[model samples]
Target: MTALSDAEFVVRTVADTACANEEYFGQLDAVVGDGDFGYSLARGFEHVLAQWDDFDRTDAGVFLQKVAQAISQRVGGTSGPIWGTAFLRAGGKLKGHETIAPADVVVALRAAVEGIQARGQAQLGEKTLLDSLVPAIDTFEAETAAGASTDDALAAMAVTARTTADATKELQAMRGRASYTGERSIGSVDAGATAVAVMLEKLAGAWPQR
Candidate 1:
């Protein structure tokens, strides 16, 4: 598929998966938060799906920028700005590219990670999604650099995402609502981290079908 089509497929899958797992995500968040993460994510992604066809499709970057607007405007709470920033930064990284290469994905993601860090004022090992996401991105980039196929790189990413997400249990919350819980948040996983892992796993699983 063309890069635009691939981007579309990934965005669609991400929205659909988030919407589908709302309750599960909420439960994860409820462990240490007010359980709003899932609702925020699902609502934002639902807007993306609801207006999917109306989005500008000039290129992957433009499409993602449009979706970022939807997510920023529609999603409630802190999640809106954080996730919207991620999408917006990625879009900015890919701006003006008619067709993207594998390396482009890494560049865009690196931008997204930076955006999330800036917007959320968080970093790796903060018991946030970054804890899992950063490592997963690193693994993907390393695998691709080592001459692995996209599929293999993505599969490794999924594995890293899952393990690192679960590993958040060993971390103390230093960001987000979970931070308010102090030591109480140590045992539970971060909902955002798990959600990232689940999304990557779902993407890896559906990639072959695509």
Candidate 2:
């Protein structure tokens, strides 16, 4: 597929995934943090989808850049900064590429993880999205290195992302408002991580057909 088509697929998948899990994320947030995460994510992706026509007219890098700006403007809370930074960094990694290769996907994942880390200043095991995304990226890279196809690599990454996200329930919160809850944060998955898992799963599912 063309870069523009791939990006469009990603955007649509993200929006749909977010909408499907909005209530679950909201419930997760209500436990140990502010309960607006679901709404914020939904709003951000909605804005992204609304601008799909405009993004389709641009290159992959510019398309992602526009998406970042749109999400940053439309979404509230840390979700805006975290997701915006992910897209912006991924865009930078894809700059000047007419078509994205499987290796390019790995590079973009690394850039996204770095961007989120830089923006949130949160480390792995912090009960944040990094807990999921970091593992997912690692799995993607490892699978790719083993000569797996893009579809297989992404599938492995999605499974790891979901597993890691679920595992976060056993960890204590070390950042965000959830940290304030101390031991109470345990037994509940991080909302951000859950959302990331959902997004990655959707991306992997869409990759094969695309």
Candidate 3:
């Protein structure tokens, strides 16, 4: 059983990843964006981690809702609202659950993907975070449906996310500031996609099942 405490660890792990990669992400964004995504997300998650001890984390829903709230309140730019909505929608699906099972995680991930799509009005192959996140969730759901353990499913998610993020370098930007760069964006990775990949990879590593 994955407890709320375990969820905290995953968030903390992602926060650590965000902080460690902030400069790298900033560099990625510098070519086409305001170059503040890394700093915004790092500070937002830092705030969430700092207040984690005071959150009502008896269940996954409450815990995730608080995390969503922190991101929305502390982070700026399109990434904040999009990420906040993803967490908020996903957490809503897990309401009333004291512990999240592997199946519950599947439901949450689906909701998160849907929320991100709805909020961003973006789709795969658009060189956004969805480029990485959608494939990871699809791989995870497929693996789990095929009788993979939580560990294996999560591992697949991490691997797929990383690969997808890297592949973004070959994709032309179709959204956000990067879109304005046209072919210039093709050789550079999407900063948002890279951040999502890092977070997913770290979360998989911190999973209780691992």
TM-score of every prediction relative to native: 0.98, 0.95, 0.92
lDDT of each: 0.92, 0.88, 0.84
Ranked by lDDT, the better of candidates 2 and 3 is: 2
- In candidate 3, the residue pairs with backbone N, CA or C atoms under 3 Å apart (3 or more residues apart, or in different chains) clash, namely none
TM-score of 3: 0.92
Deviating ranges (above 4 Å) for candidate 3? 208-210
Error of 2 at 30 (Å): 1.2
Ten-residue segment with the worst summed lDDT in candidate 1? 93-102
Global local distance difference test of model 1: 0.92
The better-scoring model by TM-score among 1 and 2 is 1
Per-residue lDDT tens digits of candidate 1, residues 82-194? 99999999998887787877799999999999999999999888899999899999999999999998888889999999999999999999988889999999998889999
lDDT of 3 by residue, 1-210 (tens): 455765667667877888788888888898787798889888888888888788777687878888999889988888788889988988898878877777787788789889988988899999999899888888988998899988879889989999999999999998887888889889888999988888887787777553
Please state every model's RMSD to the true fold in angstroms: 0.8, 1.3, 1.7
- Provide the global lDDT of candidate 3 against the true structure: 0.84
Model with the higher lDDT, candidate 1 or 3 = 1
